[model samples]
Target: MGILNKFLEKTKICVIAEKYSVAVEYAKALGCSKKDTYFEGDKYVILWTNGHICTLYQPEDYDEKFKIWKVEDLPIIPNGFWIKVRPGKGQILNSIKKIIERQEITAVCIATDSAREGNLIGEYTLMAIENKKNVYRAMINALNEKEIKAGFKNMKEDKYYKNMTLAAQARDEIDWLLGTNLSRAYSVIYGKKYYVGRCKTVLLNLLCKREEEINNFKQSLSYGVITKFKNDNCEYAGRLNYALKSESEARSIVKDICNKQGKIDSIDRDIKSIEPESLYNLNDLIRAVNRRYGYAADEVYDIAQKLYEEHKLISYARTDSRYIKKSMINDVKLIVNCINIDKFSMKKSDINNIERFIKRCVNDEKVIEHTAIIPLEVESLEEKYKLLSTKEKNVYDVIVENFLNNFLENYEYESIAFLTKVENYTFITRQNKVITHGWKERKKQDKNIVEVKEGEYVNVEDSVVEKKLSKPKERYTDDTLFEVLENPAKFVEDTKLKKILRESGIGTNATRALLLKDLIINGYVTRQQKYIIPTIPGIELVKDIRTDKLLEPFFTAVIEQQLQQIQDGELDKDELIKDTIKFLERHIEELKSIVIPDKNNDPIGKCPICKRGNIVRAKDKGYGCTNLKSTGCRFFISKEILGTYIDEKQVKNLIEEKQTDVLRFKGSKGEFSARIIWNGNKTQFKKF
Candidate 1:
């Protein structure tokens, strides 16, 4: 029995929210006469909806609409977007419907977060249930007891959230109008399946644009010089390239100056102001985890999701804001105290500095609804600290330490720049040495800068004049994903729309991670080692439609503004949809005129079995012999072995040349050569 059941005897309410744990908490907050909500809280049943319980029908999902693409019937805006209980979700929806029809229930409370999507789900479910029960809204932002209890005491009528529902409905309608119609438009005009969606298209455009940069980038060779010195105890590292140009020149200089004593010509040292790092926004956290632990964006997301739903220690993990709400201030303090209670304590100086920094950043308006993800309570914090898996533990510590450091002192450090005189040449050396670690002392071992003293000639061991090259622009990673999402215009070279999309980029934080995953899975992009390299398909897609403004960030930024206007009631939703459709239709027609190479020409290699046909790659399944249908060639290859990725070139070599080039395998095993010999009949590796 939930709180609602205890209040209204024999009562039951169906909870529908995207987050399951939050839904269960809302049920308990409504009325908690029972313990163990998932197993025994029968009086108030809590249910959940994943991002969407239903989506607009894909063109093929519709009966005659499925067979072919036709522009005449398009801008094939459906009469009205119908919502079916998603397949496999029908039973759950029906169970909730049955609960709604029970005689003892006096009313239904729409228990969901206070957001546009939440309101849409409530309104849709109400319409679907057919039960005309009295309705109240239980809108809470956080799942913590205090917030949930406070929300129940101030439950509002469902009518108060009508605008939010309208907003969500408009969002769905826009995606349907754009995705379905444009997808069909491109398919008919270009004769290939090209997709477009409110957010998906913008994301695809981002990947395509980045692909262009990587492909066209020119790499130039350069050089740098490093100096070697050794004192009795310490070994230091310094770049000598600050003196000369080419690696050859630096090497010559180093050879001449090796026996000469270099004097510290001048030393400039100053206090460097270090502000505490901002709280972890979802993207920031994902980026950090990827950097620190080698977790992919999706992997970290899964861990965070598990921590949020299963462990119930963290708050919502989907938000972009790093600021926490004023109501959460005390809770934040408690969490900080819990982490630092006995294990760690701040020095008085660090305490003062951090307090000043916190005062500067902590503002009521900066946070909305809830703060950045933090533990729900002290007990939960302690429980999470003990129960987390090693990987989870690392992520948890990052959040906790950052949360604590936010309230600690600023890291005051001294940066020293010096000019050393060596053989009548002045060498520049810049060093950022920490004078006071302050908040950084929380993770002292991970400090990037070391302490240095004025007039001290520390040994810079292992000096070399290494030839270097000016590398091309690196591909997008989880970190760069946020950067693009934050300032997409930086890449576009557009003055007008760049200014508009500068704030909210191409898509919201909630959808950015998912969008990146989709691009990779759909073959638009892939990770080459650590780089998110765009495939031939991704590259050509952009090259084929470079002038199409719809493929640019500025266009999406304009759409975002229009969407905001609709949400704010300043612009009509129908009018906005009409304008978006017109823009997309124009782009689709233009792109249709552009030629795209048949994707089949970009081959993995000739089929190993057929010897005359090509090999093709498919998602889930790897490369397959494309001659399978005509000549019964059914050979295929695996994409990875153990955890290491084997590239397409290697695959091609194994099938065409019968050997992979010499490679170094990590382990005591050393360098080896892999070969698929005897006409692809056997695989073997021998030491090189």
Candidate 2:
């Protein structure tokens, strides 16, 4: 027998924490005796649920017929949801059951994190056990002694949070209903297993569209003429805004402007000030850590949570609020003073200017359920910080930077612009001058700004036709992808729908990272360095399923709006459930016929070296001959070479003609055009 299970005979109450680390903390603050994983106090016996000890039963568990996926039986809407103990959690749960069942235990405490999902986890676990004891909710914002004691003192009857529980349960069932049913219907059509959800499927569609756009994107090379001017003030260059359609036109413009006289038309200088970044909300923290350390959103969240739970080094990591109350300025200052100032290159004069910038950091209206993430005020923080892992320190530094930067002055600069005219052509140049090295402390560029009187004539020394290539939009990086997920309204065209989506987004702050992680785990998405790329299998899933109702952000936004209404008790949950089922029924019956290409059945082209084999997509990427096993042929082509993305048409042309048409490739010196030659033996690049 463990600590609480064996010695709970004298327990006055039992406590259930959301996670093990939290349970351990409660044990300390409650003066409980710890043994094994459970703790025993004079009045309280405590253990942990380890996050959702019980979850809803899967479709297979509900019935044997549902075990095998079939389109006919899809849209698997259950009559009622039931909870069962999750796998591998039976031992701790049994221990908890034993602890709570003791006659000495008069009441139970639900000390889980204060959130909708946390409420669900605790409520579901209790529901699975069929506990009859009186239950109370302990909403803990921090894991300190004062906060824990305050939480217990202010604990309310579980019945008081019934709406929150109901809201969470409704969301849980709706997600299970939608994700489980829709994934099954789509997988059947895909001819292989595929995961799909309202949020992730749309994200996958966006990724696949990006991949297609990149492959189909053809760079149009254009030329422009620039006149280099040399005068007593400085040597500078400028150009007209228009791009020359043909090289001959650019050459003619250059010839006309070379060695010609140009007069300064106007000179404008303006000073501007940029404020420091806002406090670290969950989204902002995720973006900052991802940008600075190349960590994914999920990893950043995990690290941030560890900092919150284990070290108690920062406030709540899952908060959405980027503002604190105006009264918390002293609290923020305490933190800044506690931490070592070695990394922060602050100005001494900025210390007296703290009151000037305090307005940017504090706003009572913006403060929500929790305050912004800031370093906890502690004297030992500097010592404890040195023992942290590099990643933890990196994420911590970003939070600290955001907090400390608020005390500094605004980043101010001066922008000087000049416009020049040579004959009928006009040109412009801009130079930025740094004034205040505040938050960013960024320096000026290499270009020098020179003074010029209006209407003063200057000599155009030389001119040349500048070749420019306008490429397609960049691939989706984690940073950009997170932004899109947070603000999905950008993907839609309707202004009203955009407004709704901006309010609720695709997913909640808590679920966004986990959703992205699940997509990556199931092979629908992947991380190629900083980019979140959609795989070929991922592309095949959403290639033809895209429609305005399904692909647009409005779809998920409507679900969010309905869920919010249900949470607010404005609409009956059963009504939402009925509408969801009807939606599934309509969508399943109306699913578009998408031709998922079978590579084995439909190859791109025949292999040039080995005519017996057909070229198809390789495992990771690119294309390779199918007869590599039988004939030992090694013919293959990559998707990219020298930073240029290749298309399927190029692969087909290379196989049929034994040589490809001139294509652009990046060389060591610069970007150049080349042709691939298959000389009966191997491939060779023929550069122009």
Please give the distance, in angstroms, between residue 519's alpha carbon in candidate 2 and its true position after superposition: 1.8
Candidate 2 Cα RMSD after full superposition onto the native fold (Å): 4.9
Winning model by lDDT = 2
Per-candidate TM vs. native? 0.76, 0.86
lDDT of all the models against the reference?
0.63, 0.79
Give residue 65's error in model 1 in angstroms: 3.9
The alpha-carbon deviation from the true structure for residue 503 of candidate 1, after best TM-score superposition, in angstroms, is 1.6
**Decoy 1 TM-score against native:** 0.76
Best by TM-score: 2
Task: Give the lowest summed-lDDT range of ten residues in model 2.
Answer: 1-10
lDDT of 2 by residue, 493-528 (tens): 888988888888877777889988988899878776
Candidate 1 Cα outliers beyond 4 Å, as residue runs = 1-15, 32-51, 57-63, 101-107, 130-135, 208-218, 224-248, 251-265, 340-361, 380-384, 422-424, 442-464, 493-496, 591-688
Residue pairs with backbone atoms closer than 3 Å in model 2 (clashes): none
